[model samples]
Target chain A: MGPSLLLRAEGLKRQLGDRLLWSQLNLVLAAGDRLGLVAPSGAGKTLLLRALALLDPLQAGTISLQGRPPATWGLPRWRSMVLYLAQRPTAHGGTVEANLRSPWEFQELRGRGGWRYERIKGWLQALGRDPSFLAYDAERLSGGELQLLALLRALQFDPSVLLLDEPTASLDGATTAALEALLIEWLAAGQRACVFTSHDSEQIQRFATRTLELRP
Target chain B: MTPMTSGALTISDGRLALSALLILVNVGLSAALRLGLTRSLLVASLRMVVQLLLVGFVLEWLFRQDHAPLIVLVGAAMAMIAGISAVQRTRRRFAGIYLNSLLSVMASSALVTGLAVTGLIQPQPWYDPQYLIPLLGMVLGNTLNGISLGLDRFMEGLRSGRDQVETALALGATRWEACQEVVRDAIRVAMIPTINSMMVMGLVSLPGMMTGQILQGATPDAAVRYQIVILFMIASATALGVFGVVGLAYGRLTSADHQLRLDRLVG
Candidate 1:
């Protein structure tokens, strides 16, 4: 691995009870790399993504950020840079604005300071969300809306790499295109990278520079 | 008015024999309704009789002892037994729960008992067995309930809210911050019974200690004032016990890297 790589995992393995989810896996996300993770249903695509994001423990492997093992970089520090966005994320019960503003209250993020409303409103606008969307009660939002808010929260944190699990699965075609555009804008902003798991190969062809497929 | 003392009234051998009617009523009802509890009723009654006889003899010896250290030993033994029972009542098993519960129960019981002997009850010679035993028993009993309720809620909450906890961790929150809500919930669950009892203390019914004190020929005013102190003491002890156990569990249930060691939780 060269210095260009932002995140890497080697010989990764995960298990559920006595059943093996996957074994002897390797993954790499470099600067500006768009990696598409494709696998059939029940193939543990989310599990692998979570493992790469450091949300799930590695059964037998090593995950490194900037060539440092997670142990040395520290989880909070590592995860702050290498983020994972779940398929269906849960939020603290509040308005959309409150949900977006919540993570900043965390001590780790506290040193990074708070979210900027103008910047978030700009990002939300790129996703075709109006300013009023921020004021909407988060509990009442639809699945797609929730995903958008989740994505927006992740994007605002400026993570260098993102493990997106079925991020656009619930969005309509127009919103999906807007999400792609928003992601592109995010990538273009800095030394950023993304991994997306989607059934839509067409979206992968357009968005990801390469793809990894998991077999049952 | 000065408090009057009455001679201790003893239940005679005939009266003690007549107390068997309580068991008879249960057995008779089980047979009449086909409730199938007759065997359990008989066993429980027999166990209670034998256990009480042994405890009575032991209490007699404890009361006779002029030694102060005997008080500590007895209190510790009671706390250990209460701790075991508290952990046993939790349907879920937690790693290192025995130590956690035992420490919490001992700490709360000791602290509350110390306060009682030093200030509130102020039994002369402090280690006076009569006051120490009953006070320790009451503190241990309430602390036991609080700890069991806390352990049950904390484990169940962590299991059910794993995702939420994980999400918070991923967002760079520490383990304590991530599980803050669940910890708060555990405290609430543990404190509920004590709170409810306080609420209904005098209005709905007479409480146990008050009833016993009144039956022992204490004036109603004295009984009521003692009950007030007792209610406050109970609530304080329960909070301390619940916090000690639940707070210790948070450390045990997570790793240094802020990951939840949910696997540590057994059946």
Candidate 2:
């Protein structure tokens, strides 16, 4: 069989007020899969992404992490394994490192432990920044820089699936290229999967090995 | 003690009428500015006068009765009214909102007021109307505002900061972790006015309760001591109320799965 599935969404239906965003939707992500979602604006790309991440509730659908229902896995544990990085990344006050450190402080994450300093240092270097970047004030970071921090924050968790909602929308060409390269290396390093929703067709063509097109 | 030995003065009806003369300024200003509030001002004044008169009569009758159950009944009624007023001020709607506010009011008022009356004041009978009613009234009033302000701030914060909260949740936070910042900020905002009032009490102005005691002939020394005691009582009551209301609202707005139930809130 193909590589074992990391996450699956079956018969997913989303409704916004009287409008139906999507119905009878099915999606699957196997290990090392780079799944891209292409949709016109307001096609519920973000909603679908959030629903998979369990940030938004589905009208009538069940999301399974691995082969089991999310309820069996526990929400906090399931969420840690399937992280959602929003389009417009933001952080509370403190240094960039603090933004990364905050999640570990949660009780759910406390028992799971934290990242090694070397891995974060290596990720920063891979993103074309040095270790000193950790000292940058989170609130003072530019939009592009905040996106980088957001990506690194979730990546450090070593989730099985990464749902990126227009993750590179604010990045310049060089940063986007760097981020894409880093993500490719990360996926290759483990049996991880990634799903992205972006307007950039070129980025999709270059990055996504499989594509799901949605019509409004 | 003899009449002069009391060392207190009472206002005669004529002097009280002279005090009423202050309303003419409000009347003239309303007319001059076309504020159109003259009717409202008069109605408010009339309501205040009538309500206070009725309450005074009721209290006189209550003080004469040595029955303890009446004190409990009146205190319960006062707390119920304060709780409803607190909810009205917030202007938020949810299921069992009355119970939400009422539980907080009763818990905070009972715990703190109970402590002050039994531990400090210790009047002859535990339910002495002279001590219990006024203490309950003041504590209830201050806590009503605290809980209201706290609930309003919390609801508004969650409504606006939905994304931030969800982001934290998606990153593996429990509902408590996701909303802790908003909760703390809201409660802090709720407590600020009470804190500021405490800071400026002696310097800025004598509080109404103290001034009233002084005007009615209690010595300044005794009034100041009583004011200090009541200030502490109010502070405790407000903190307890804020704690109770925030806890309840959070419990109401979230579910066992740690979902933020924004749909539960009504416009």
Candidate 3:
């Protein structure tokens, strides 16, 4: 219940079919915290992120954002505040710009202000992408490019918490560094925090303020 | 052109048996091609013959009775059967899928048929079996196809596009917003057959109801008008039924929490 706490999970549990993946899990994220998750492959790292974002049902326990439960804020609002970025994010069958702007089409995010073109352009430039990248068909983009697009799509929404599942798995060294820098900058801007899983232990050591290990 | 006053020639039981001989042609083709469909063809043909004969006898008895309640009961039964058949045609099922199909079929068919019987045709009584039963049957048959196609397409689309749907949801979309595209595609798929049939109705082939009326000694002009009314009724009912089933599916597949409940789907 710290004043800077942005997200809290108490006694979270998850299972896939009859096999229990993890249980008695707890998380507390404070403003400007970059929490890295360490778990072996097939250990349900993605499921934990989904559970935190309310994208999947929780088998047990509670999750709250900024001292408020998901039910009180309602799903759309809660999800808007705590966004989950998947490793293989969907492109939505349109231009990259359209995919980025798609979230604004929802009434839930309308009041958050529409997508800003100049800001996206700046981010693209940082990621070594030209303005022409926006015109590229999202479905045809390479895996790394899609990951960038997905990141921008989430970043523009300015959510308080981000649950990133292997976000840089497909990116090369240079782009991964740039993405980490960009995320650091984003986290510095507000009472923001993120929990991310990285297969690369070096990247996790470099980026995370602290690490949480999930053992089977 | 002069109108012929002669009614359709009645076929005796012997002549009807003679018509059954045509199946030999299909049986011959199946045997010659080694298609191995002879047994299935014979069984299907027998079933069709028995089913039509039973329906004919039931219609005769139903028409003889002027009871409104009994006619309505028959209509409900038809809707229930149509609902079951609609679900049976889908490759996927979920809890309450049958109920969803039944409610959608029953609601749309009842609405369109009631409007047509009372508002347009205005038979001696609204539940007059001769008119109500046939009209309801036609509407229910078409609606059954529409709901089946729509539900199947919808469930499959959601299953295949699970990532896209979850992506939208994570981007702060409501359940309806996340599923709008799939729902639209499903409804469009459902409406295609109905629209295509309407497009080439008279030019491509004579409609069954119109041909039946003409065979029963009705003038072509009167039969054409009834056919036109029936066509419009079928179109309306099919559209409504597609929307009904797709809407219900949308509700079941997504939840108040804006989560995609793909776990609810049973393949």
Candidate with top TM-score is 3
TM-score, one value per model? 0.89, 0.90, 0.96
**Model 3's CAPRI class?**
high
lDDT of 3 by residue, B39-142 (tens): 99999999999999999999989888788888899999999999999999999999999999999999999999999999998887788788899999999999
| lDDT digits (tens) for residues A114-147 of candidate 2 | 8678999988888899888999999899999999
Q: Candidate 1 clashing pairs?
A: none
- TM-score: which is higher, 2 or 3? 3
Which residue ranges in model 2 land beyond 4 Å of their true spot?
Answer: A111-113, A213-216, B1-8, B32-37
lDDT score for residue B171 of model 2: 89
Fnat of model 1, as a fraction: 0.53
Candidate 3 — which residues are off by over 4 angstroms?
A1-3, B1-7
What's the distance in Å from true for residue B98, model 2?
3.2
The list of candidate 1 runs beyond 4 A from truth reads A1-3, A17-20, A71-73, A111-113, A213-216, B1-8, B22-46, B221-225
Candidate 1 lDDT over A1-216, as tens digits, reads: 543778888888878888877888888887888899877778899888777767756789888888888888778877778888888887778899998988888877886758888998888888888999999999899999999988988877888898898899999999999999888888877888988899887988888888887753
Model 3 score (lDDT): 0.92
Return the TM-scores of chain A for each candidate in numbered order: 0.94, 0.96, 0.97
Deviation from native of the Cα of residue A176 in model 2, angstroms: 2.1
Cα deviation of B176 in candidate 1 (Å)?
1.9
lDDT of 1 at B42: 90
DockQ each candidate and list the results. Answer: 0.58, 0.63, 0.85
